[model samples]
Target: DLSEILSLHDFEAVARHTMNRRGWNYYSSGADDEITMRENNTAYQRIWFRPRILRDVTKVDFSTEILGHKSSMPVYITATALGKLGHPEGEVVLTRAAHEHGIIQMIPTLASCGFDEMVDAAAPGQVQFLQLYVNADKSRTKKIIEHAGKRGVKALFITVDAPQLGRREKDMRTKFEGNASSHQTKGGDKVQRDAGAARAISSFIDPSLSWKDIPFLKECAGDMKIILKGVQSWEDAVLAAERGCDGVVLSNHGGRQLDTAPAGITILPEVVAALNQRGLLVPPGKPRFEIMVDGGVRRATDVLKAVALGATAVGVGRPFLYSMSTYGFEGVCHMLQILKDEFEMNMRLIGAPTLTDVVPSMVDISALKVPTVGNTMFGVNYETMYPAGV
Candidate 1:
């Protein structure tokens, strides 16, 4: 049954059936209206490809570096919280899978398993990055950063989008539902309570997180690359670069915050352009600042498209979670293998013998900004999957 799951979307279909109702809603639903969530996928459709022919593509390479770490592909598993909602092993499942495949995994601050536990589960010498949700207490935040630094975390991604949790209506509706005992904590306490998983777990995120704290975080991080996650605007991206931040992930918190925020891929050009205009887009051979994107990356073609637009790499979130939920560690490995196959085939078709060969000329994104009706297939399918009033 797991072998039949050939695509990332297939993993979602299985996860929808296998995961409990509350967990599914929490992982799948975005903020109110869910417009941004839908757009994240549809926007990719707007960018058409211009495949080249007559190029010898006997062997193609998908290997690349992210934040100075060697990865087998240009994609890395992005951070998603409360991994136990999908699997009992929590983020450790992803840790093992990513290590086996020679890819990086970003450990979530609010993981179901503790930070140290997840790192301990990793294969020896496996590269891991830490995603930080700044705590209201400065000392608490400092301690976490220092501990992660000691644990051999290669980078520190500071989440900047969620000072306050968004109103995810699906999760809100599921709040009164009974907790699944498997997801409970050591003290027999439910990891989530009445406020729904997002709100309940994010209470410690400091609302006052601002530019002034960047220098303090740099001091705490101590040589680990500090990248700002959830950066949307070109202005903010520019500021992140100017402030000595090592990189910026152009994300909207997977549309979980700010319902109408633009898709990460949609804003990639502007961010790259701004960085270039300021001479901050890292020059060749320098340990330079990186640009990354995460949201609605369902295929290897999506990864290729982002690279063409000048991203150092792309981050994938829900797909791996759904994969793990549906088939555990095997599902995760299979999903990566599927992506690898797709990347190879697509890269050859696009006439790119290597990742660096994937240039801006290979894609046509002129229709990206035009306001047209988006495909409502996801909405229709979602409604069919969870019909109104149950």
Candidate 2:
């Protein structure tokens, strides 16, 4: 019955209609006026694709590796908390679908179900990265890292953007909020006793996280690759390397954090340029530390664009959840399949035999321009659609 209801766009429409307005608002709404959220997609539109032809398009490969883990495609399922809100299986459904597609699924630390259950549900060696929110309880954070290590999670993504949740006006107006202290399933100490309250919840992110914490994180992670998510500047990218991070997920938390920050794509080139300058991109005998990006990625062309700009891979957020809301596990699986197909088509049309062939030359940056104020030059802040930092 549900197969007939399938379509990527329909997922959003159906989800909006099926879920309570409050729940929908909580999931769909972004921070502040959602200016950055709007810009995340708009900036992608501004960059037009110049597809190349005249290649043998019959065969195309979408498989790639990120930090030593292989994936059928370069897309990773960006972590989001509380999947049970959409379905009973929650992360199990999402991870199972991701495993079926052979892509990475980053499981959130604040996930509704126990981490062990999620790891157990995943197909063995099906690449799952554990995402942590840096809880106020350092001991709890340590226990989480240890738990993940035992689960054979491939990597740890420390999300830094949400020291505290963003100001989602729509959710605020609707009085719909996501509570950290609430439990979706029975018998977990992770859930808060009260789920009905509305208030700001902190991720216990260590504001003290400096270059100093990197070594400690390495110690805690054992040998699991560590990536610092939410990096948006060249300095931070380079520092991440110095601090021994395996990668940097260039993002602004889908523009949910820092409403005025530049789009992740806008700063990606800068990060790549820095990596190339220092030779930090590749490790001793392996590929360089990965530079992955996420935000406003809705199409395969966008995935191609990120790869061309030096992202080893890209992460997809809200849209996957939207698909989940619309059609559950099958919807998410189909979404990935469609993206993989599109990515391969894009690679062939753009004359890329492999992911490495997706070079800067493949992208027409001439279409990219900077803005000015009279005689003063300034960097274009894509979020504000204006000039900043002259």
**Best prediction by lDDT:** 1
Provide the lowest-lDDT 10-residue window in model 1: 377-386
lDDT of 1 by residue, 59-178 (tens): 999999999999999999898987888898888999999998999999888788888888899888999999988877788789889999999999999999998889898887777343
Give the per-residue lDDT digits (tens) of candidate 2, residues 270-338.
Answer: 677677668788757865788988888888888888887778888987777777866788888878877
Q: Between which residue pairs do clashes occur in model 1?
A: none
- Steric overlap count per candidate: 0, 3
Once fitted onto the true fold, the runs of candidate 1 whose alpha carbons sit more than 4 angstroms away are 176-192, 283-286, 371-390
Q: Which ranges of candidate 2 are over 4 A from the true structure?
A: 1-7, 174-205, 283-286, 369-390
Error of 2 at 202 (Å): 3.2
User: If scored against the real structure, what TM-score would every candidate get?
Assistant: 0.91, 0.87
CA lDDT scores, all candidates in order: 0.85, 0.73
